[model samples]
Target: MGIKALISKPFAAFTISKMNKWKYNAVAAQEKVLQNLINTAANTQFGKDHQFSKIKSHQDFIQHVPINDYEDIKPYVEKVVKGEADILWPGKPLYFAKTSGTTSGVKYIPISKESMPEHIKAARNALLCYIYETGKTDFLDGKLIFLQGSPVMDKKAGISFGRLSGIVANHVPKYLQKNRLPSYDVNCIDDWETKVDAIVEETLNEDMRLISGIPPWCQMYFDRLLAKTGKQKIKDIFPNFKLFVYGGVNYEPYRAKLEESLGFKIDSIETYPASEGFIAFQDSQKEKSLLLLADAGIFYEFIPTDEFFNEKPSRLNLGEIELGKNYAIVMSTNAGLWAYSLGDTIKFVSKNPYKLLVTGRIKHYISAFGEHVIGEEVEHALLTVAKQENVEITEFTVAPQVNPQKGEMPYHEWFIEFVNPPKNLKEFAVKVDEALQQKNIYYKDLISGKVLQPLIIRSLKAASFINLMRTEGKLGGQNKVPRLANDRILADKLEQYIIEK
Candidate 1:
């Protein structure tokens, strides 16, 4: 066996065995996880405020600490940002993951010393689980390239601040660093366009066996690599490449283009990591759904999406969740977040192993006309249209055009950037509209009753999304086009580049 196999095999086996045990007894495992989290933070300010010490069961904990979003929790996070001790966690946070804020310019999420290791461990186990299930260790023998954010973190108030991906990249274990591509100096480049060029230049000839990044940026890397080498496919340059690990956005829309670029079918793994914590990952080689990390130092609660905006919504624990229900995920993590709403919605697909598919964001949707179009429905419609028309879409976003100045009703406007334009744009738009109507009954009724006009399709100029991302100041890792918006804020901003078809 190779050195890589020698190092990974035993650990992979152990992880799979433990994961299997936890899978069957997820409820019991989660209960223990919650108790441990409560005990660990019982003396902290947040814990005391929430009466964590007095809480003994899930019922008591839920009643004590109400569910909260970023806005609701920002005050406590602000205390941590000001270098206050024991505000959220026991001591000051090790670092703050700077992400785009919902109401403010930026959000500083705490990363305590106790929680940082869980983030790293969950990430490591994601790969180990893949290896354990697939018996694919040869890829580990070659260099792995992770297209992450700039590793140069800025320090503020004695705490480091940067993207979660960058923070993780900066802390890559010494052993793995030897097999990781793109030297640290190149990774430190802050400008994304320049950094991608440097990455292309540095790893052009390396034995790249794996690549991991969000889909759009990774597509940029592959496009540049192909352009530089004058190659038909990526496999032409890196024959050993075997895997692609991706997260942050749905990979279905970009799958065709990604596979085309690679020139061969390769195993792909998906992970659900956020500034809050690493939540879940694809555990089985045969399944697309992600297995929830029940024992990964984070306690999970689910609130039905339909009632999440209600005055008082019911929350379900791991034991109470039913299959095929959409829920807004609430987490109480080792990072000291209590009943925190991550804002993302997910639907459970399997019950025994607790596998789920991320549906969309809570605030990201179109309900301007009472049609209630969601991100999942939009993605499914787009995917259906793309398949029917044999076109490849690079990026897309939807917004409700609420005010029609002319003698017409308001409609859902779709701005699409296509890599391969459809043979007939009008037909493609009709098919997309029909597919959406089929998926959502309310949307169908609205269209049939003429309460809402037919969906409008406005083709975007090639690479227009890149300009859009630049204008929005979210140009790189972990940032993506917001798929659906309730208002015309993003649509009006992108109107200048729309091809008036």
Candidate 2:
């Protein structure tokens, strides 16, 4: 074993042992984190404005601070961007993580000195926990490729500004610097396609063992790899490849295709990292749930998704959350965010250690006709049916078809780019519709009541979603296509990309 492989054994043990102190005492750790954050930032202007010094309990914290979306806290973020000291955190942030969304244009999220370590440590400890669980550390000796954004940062009011991944690139530990692949210059390329091509060149012959990125971007890199080397399987190019780490989007839709392209089933770790915080990670190889980072400088509140739009939603702290119920996560962090709504939804599967599965985006749902359909339900329905039919989906999205052609009833329109499309498309669509009805009662009622017809599947051209993402200027690095939309904006746009058989 290489020195890293040998050293990782004790390191992993020490790290996971330290982690257990908080994991077993998760709720208490959360309470302490909230108090620490509040106490630490009490001298800041935001703290004073919100009566942080006076707050003694979670309820008091909620009463004092309203749950804020990015829009609600835009003023504070603006001030922070202007180099205002103690505007949000105790002092000016070390960096601004610049993120752009479809609806919310550009957002500058603060990365305070205190919060930065939390992000870094949580990521590092994820690997440690994995090593402890599986006793696999030899991959650390081989080149580790992080399919990420440009490491080049920009200046905003003298504060370093860049994508979260880029900011993280600056923090890659010196030890792993030698093992990291895709030269810095290649990573700096602006165009994603150009970057992937360059990456293929740089890491083609390297002893790459671990690959990490969002699923779509990783697929892009794999495609580029095969094109450049003419390798049938990724494992053929780098037989050492054993681990695939992914975040940002659900991997179920792309899993079969990725494994097929790679020519083998590989180990994967799902991470829940947002610009706001490093929330959770898969600690066990056996379970799909990601272990929540309770002591990672972020205090979490689970507001039931059903009550999210109410005047004052019930913001339940860690102890109050129940398993199997969907909740919109609200976080108060050392970054100085007070009761910030993350806009992502999650369901708890385990309680003591607080392991969870990210269901979908809170607002990214299909509720056009009162039959609220979520990403989890849709994915479960489609993937379940597709598996039984031996169909492989490359990419897909759903939109409510509020209006249909003359003499036809409106229905849910599924636009799918299939890797292995079913032989009988109509029968497959019926199976998917039935699966969806089994998952959601509202959707079943609408279908049975004749208010809506069974879903219609539109087989899209190969790389349709890719072309759409590229055209929208969001081709890579944590950008994801929403699985379903309530409005026709995305769905309507997808109409032109459709290919009729």
Candidate 3:
């Protein structure tokens, strides 16, 4: 279905006679969109040739796709590598968004011109929904500091990646475009280092009213900004920075450090940003995450977290899903990714389809040793331990690594940067272990010597962690220190610094 039809379809499916009455209409509309996708995909050559053509019903679609991971899509990506078009979409692609695939190699996902409006509208709906929930529409009128992806692609007619933010930046409304804090659009520039440097120079003097971007990149920007001005507080640089909008990864680990670095507790909002599109945002003033734009061209599927890694993950479309359980998000966008599993996991906070929270990345989950520990579980467990001990953290990452000692099970090791380091580090470690044990039965079993050993909490000077990432060519700019490293490569590297010392 076209964008205009997609918008109106929901209303037509159910009676959205008034604004308050629109909720039922949304649910109805979502089903219609899915039906349309099933029909359209059956008719299209790409869809027909692909497995999606066999999807006689939504249930069949879920049963057929097999919940693809990045490895499964590698062959398609190889096609993309050869400059092939019409693989995912019907028409010639506008460009690709070059985002690093967390589990494997860097991915260059195609974006089509037709899909661009869906992206734009998704962003608009995300913003409008936030405003609708909090009555904060006036905030959009302020000077905005967008910490967007730097444009590395030279503008041309050919399909390319690394131009997502550039495309979005150039495509926003002209009136709002005129009001941007810095005239420079980082996403449009070819050289990242030069673009970032220019952005740093431009914002040095301007009153940065609102800052928005991935938290890691924003953190780097703020860190450099603070260092340059010789100021300890965030207010010192951008006195007018009323709102701090961050998305992408979980910001819990960095929250204490960010608050410490900034010098004030600014209101923060977490958004779910993807290479495909902006999926959701925390719309409530109380800071709760919401789901995808229900009325947009995006259609969603939720696979139960328990079955997420299974070969045939049993899926739940909008009507079948329930609240409070984690689900692997499968999505179909106007971008032509039918039943595309984007490796994101979320928990429903409310019964409303739009009310949801980003719990963790699907790849970040650790169940290797039967301990299905997720990012939220770890974050909460750490918080519980900290609260009990009255200690505060700057930043942290948790990894499950094999214990070097003979006959020991895999254990979770934490690299923590502390604001208030406990005098007795061993006691602090015990407290954290106790908290995790209480949180998860599996963790408790592991701690009691039935399975794994007690988790080891290693404290590192905050600067050391920062320097480590910097030395790896991953420090500063948009790169974030990975929170939950699944394998030995990152875990072993961290172990050398955190364990040996």
Candidate 4:
């Protein structure tokens, strides 16, 4: 056996065994995880405040701890930042994953040594599981290029701070580091544009076997590689490339374009890892759904999307979740997060293995004029329209046009940056409107009652999204265009950047 296969053989076996055990008894596995999480941190301040010692069951834990967002947890995190020990997790956190804040500047999430292993181990198992199921071990022999964020970490109040991906990239195992591309020196370049240029120069002649990144940014890297090599597709440059692993955004819209760039079909794996913890990953090649890591370091709770905005919402554990319902995910993790709102929404597709699809974000939707449209609905409508029109969309965003002149009704306006523009823009808009009306009853009712007008579509020039991200200081690496907005806050700004036909 090759060195790659030899190194991964034991891990692949372990992952498969764990997958089988969890598949048969996901509920039991989740309950055990919850009990372990409680017992692990029962002495921490947060655990004591919630009376974790007295808590005997999931119900007791929920009854004591309320669901919290970043704002609610800031005070405790602040204490940790000031060198306080055992504020949330036992002792001090090893590092802090700094995530982009919605209103605030940046939110520092704790990542304890206790939880770091969970993140690294789960990601490793995700790949190993894919290898076991597909018998695809050649990737282990070649280089794996992970287009991650900058690994240059900053010390703040005795803790390291940087992007979660960057931190994880720095921690690639010693054995596998030989197959990983982009030297550590190049990864430390903080400027995104400069980093991409350096990565292109470094990996141009390498024998790459696997590529992992968010789709849009990975597309950027692939474009650069093609340009440098004068190649038509990525496969032409890296013939042995076998897998494309991605996460942080839905891959549906980018799938067609990415395949076109690759020149052939390749297997893919999707993972759902947040700054707080690694949540779920695609285990079975037969299904697109991601299997929840029930036995991992995180304990999960779900609140129905419709009830989440209420003052008090009912929470359900893994055993209580029903398929097909949208639920806002709440998580308690080894990283010192307790009943924390991860701001993500998901819909279960399978129960035996507890597989799910990420539906949307909790605060990301358009409900102006009572036409409640979510990110998933908008993406589905756009995909339908694109497929029907034989077009490819690179990036897009939707916002409600609530204010109208006299004799005008409210409507949802779409700003789309297309790789392949449709032959007829008017027809494309009509198809999109029809799709949305079919998918969302609220939107359809508004249109039927004349409370809303037909959806508006505006085409943006190529690379407009890159410029938008540049202007917002989030040009690359895990930053994605917000798919839906309640109002035209972003739409109006984007209008200035829109290309006139």
Candidate 5:
């Protein structure tokens, strides 16, 4: 082992032990976190406005604070943006994570001095847990690359603002600084394609051991690496590339194609992170579940996804959540967000140690008909059939086709970009349709009752999704194509990329 591995092993063990303490006492940990947040923010303007001093229990909290979306907090956020102090939290925010918003145009999420360390700590502890589980800390010695957004920060009234991934880039630990790939100058490049080309050039000949990013962007990086070096598999270019750290999207749909490009299977770690907070990470190699970060400076709540839009949805605390049921995640954090809805859906996989899987975005689902298929269901259906048929899916999305030709039933249109096209498109579509039907009984009923026709597969040429993303200026960073959509907004754009065959 290299000196780095030697140093990290003991530290990894220590961190895992400390983290396990929270796992065993998850409920108490959250209670303490909520209390701390209340006490710390008791003097802030929001605290005063909400009668924070009188709130003592979760019930009290619920009575005083209704769940808030970004618009609900925008007025206070505007105050912070104008350099106001003690408006939301204790003081002015340390940074603003700027994200593209729908109605608001751009959302500037606050990251307080007290909350920033939790993000770094959660990321570090995730790696530590991986090392402790597999005893493979040697990756730390070689070059590591995180295919991320630019590290450039735009200052507003003395506070830095940038993509959350880019902001995290600025906080890399000193120990790994020398080993991290893609020089600062390259990372600062604005355009995705240009930045990717620069990353390929920098890491083409380096001893890269670990690659990290959203799977699609990482796929884009691998494509660039292959084109630059004319190598068939990524392993040919970086033999030591053993670990893949990915977040933001489920990897099952991308697994077959990604491994085909890699030339072999490799271990991976999935993380559940957002601008709101770093929520969870895969703590074990044996299971896909991500251990929730109860002690990570955030208190969490859940409302059953079906009831999310209800006038008075039942908000259940962490200990009250049951396994395998989809719930919309809500959070209150040291960042000054109180009873804030994350707009993400998650299902708990294990209650003992508090492990969960991100099921979908609360708003990103196909319910045009009564068949409300979610991100997890669609991914599972497509991935299962792809693996069985020996087909490789490069990218795919499902949108409701409520409008159809005369005398034809409406259907769900699946736009797929395939590496290995199925030999019989009709047969392949039937299998995928059946798989989805099995997962969603509502879809099955619609099909059997002749309410809708089976799904249609519109296979597209290679790089179709990539080109669309590029055209839309979302080709990289945290951006990803949605798995399911209720409307044809994205489907209409995808039509132009369809392969005529």
Candidate 6:
């Protein structure tokens, strides 16, 4: 809007266009790179195979390499830990990134030391894209406050590539590292609480210009900051702050609260962080969901949502995919993961391949009945119903509960917390029922007596639910009661608190 910004608009636009083009080109080149890696991994016997076998096409590779889970790679991880060079990939094994495995408490994911450069490049590209889109290169000089894991190392720990955060911290410039705040370094294998006191101390050292981390953890950190400094407005504490980069979960549900507490329209960016890799970022001006980093060190394979959880998946390539359709993401990464399911779903916003929006987690879905309900669907439904009834649902959740009285159809019990309570509560409930029925045909037919119509709108105080979670031992800053519930156990627990009150 300024004279300088107006004059410089075209240059910024050009940079964005060029960066987007570069990403598109990278997507197009994925097949060749993937083939090369597959061949090289096979030739060098990275995991189990030994022989540079030919993979002429995408189909050939998929057909030959069986789809594998973490369990399949456990042996290779063991080998790498024993200093078995080139066991996972044809390079020195970097340190392992620890991930919360489903069964195993923690699993160390392996990465090639050579691939570290790729991670840096991908991260830089995200920054460059952000700069181009926001047209805010002036903030580049400001101190960035990355709300990342603490950079503590175990005395006997050797440099491993699996803990993604540790790898990043290890690679940051030593000069910048020295100036980093006195926080509990928890990137190493250590209890997080051990360093909490130290982290609180470090946060007071300087005014952070940029804040980056998972939304929950960042919120928790700020809550701690509030306690430490007796401050409410984060901007007052860190007056120079320009951006708040968050990811690892959807921020929409908590955005209003965060903005209110911060006291500024903080520029926000979302990132895709995983044990396998830092996959994508939010770079668009309007869209809030993360854009797939197509040009990053991973070649993507998308399995249709219906086909994703199947034992035998029908995977689609970039050339074969469509927009708005949900797909489970699989990637061949520089970290030596081939056709690995990333446990996330994404939809393409544009055909550019490099740009995508993460929809939700694969595991987080509630289809108790025939009505398939995902987090996005639930969020959209809540907004729609609230709009129709002229109310704002500040907090809500849907759960399937059994109606043992025999004749009634099972209902989706909703617990809603509204900023402005609706006077026409019955009409509000009807509107919500109508919204659900219209959006999902299964629910519509069910409402027509084919099955049970969903019950909507049981209101409760917001703090009551928060207090319940606290009682359940998930307290303090980060813990949030899940927005959707499928089973009766968690649903019953939530119902007991909100149903009566």
lDDT of each: 0.89, 0.91, 0.67, 0.89, 0.91, 0.65
For residue 206, give model 2's deviation from the true position in Å.
Answer: 1.0
TM-score between candidate 6 and the true structure: 0.82
Over 4 Å off, model 3: 1-24, 50-56, 63-65, 73-85, 102-104, 130-141, 154-157, 185-197, 387-390, 406-410, 476-478
Model 4, position 304: C-alpha lDDT score: 97
Each model's number of backbone clashes? Answer: 0, 0, 4, 0, 0, 17
Regarding TM-score, does 3 or 5 come out ahead? 5
Candidate 1 positional error at 148, Å: 0.7
Q: Where does model 2 exceed 4 Å of error?
A: none
Better of 1 and 2 by lDDT: 2
lDDT comparing candidate 4 with the true structure: 0.89
> TM-scores of the models, in the given order?
0.97, 0.99, 0.86, 0.97, 0.99, 0.82
Clashing pairs in 4: none
In model 6, the runs with Cα more than 4 Å from the true position are 1-21, 44-52, 153-163, 174-201, 224-232, 384-398, 402-408, 414-430, 456-501
lDDT by residue for model 5 (1-501), tens: 888889999999899889888898999999999999999999999999999999898889999999999999999999999899998899899999999886779999999988888888988988899999899987998999998888899988889999999999999999889999889999999998999998988888899999999998898888888888889999998898889999999998888878988999999999988998999999999999999999988999999999999999999999899999999999999999999999899999898899999999998999888889898888888889888999988899989988887868999999999999999888999999999999999999999999999999999988999889889988888898988888899999999988873
- Model 2: per-residue Cα lDDT over 287-309, one tens digit each: 99999999889999999998999
User: How do the residues 1-501 of candidate 6 rate in per-residue lDDT, one tens digit apiece?
Assistant: 334335445655665676666566755667766766776677445434623375677887777666666787778767766666666677655667666664555676776655676666555556666667777754444455555553444321364433466557667644345334443243332433434445667666675766767665566566667778898788778887787777666776556556766887888777776767777777765776566666556778888887866888788888788888888888877668777777778887776544677777676666776666666776666676665555654566777765635676677777776656677777877776777667677767766875776565678765555556656754432234566666656656666556343
Put down candidate 1 lDDT per residue, 1-501, tens digits, no spaces: 579767797889987887788888888999999999999889888898888889999999988999987888888888888788888778888889998875866888888888888788877888998888788899888899999988888988899999999999978888789999789999988888898999999999999998999999999999999999999999999999999999999999889889899998889999999989999998877888998989888899999988989988998998898888889999998888889999899998998888999999988989987787889999999998798778998899999877877778989999999988987888888899999999999999999999888898889998899998887777888888889999888888889998874
TM-score of 5: 0.99
